[model samples]
Target: LLSRLYRPLRVCGVVANDGQSGGGPFWVQAPDGVVVKQIVESAQVRMDSLVYRTIIDLEFLKHVDF
Candidate 1:
């Protein structure tokens, strides 16, 4: 089930995960057949009257053949 959803995105050579802890849990294989395990740490800091910011780029999809 996971493979089906990831296959299309993987073919494009890009993948992204967003979650608050444990990093979404998944595996990715690069176009070169190199498999990689990713673990994105969840935010663990808080500030009074402060805002945290994060930016993600989706431009890779534009270059994807599929």
Candidate 2:
């Protein structure tokens, strides 16, 4: 059921990529101050901004232990 799918986890997760794959995870802030995890593709973020790219790299740490 959707309720089972929506169950909260006791902890957040982080996974490292030694540079092979593309997409990564990030904490995106909502207008109301709620921050949620999002899986972002490399081409989807602003590659021109160093800050944004770096932040995206940080976000890349979470996900992919599977």
Top lDDT prediction, candidate number: 2
Q: In model 1, which residue pairs have backbone atoms overlapping below 3 Å?
A: none
lDDT of 1 by residue, 1-66 (tens): 576467645322333533223322224466878666443233432323244222112344223331
Mind giving the per-residue lDDT tens digits that candidate 2 earns over 1-66? Answer: 585469875554445766676666666786877676666677877889998877766643554453
Q: After aligning candidate 1 to the native by TM-score, how far in Å is the CA of 42 from where it should be?
A: 16
How high is each candidate's TM-score? 0.23, 0.49
Clashes of 2: 0
Give the runs in model 1 whose Cα sits over 4 Å from its true position: 1-23, 39-66
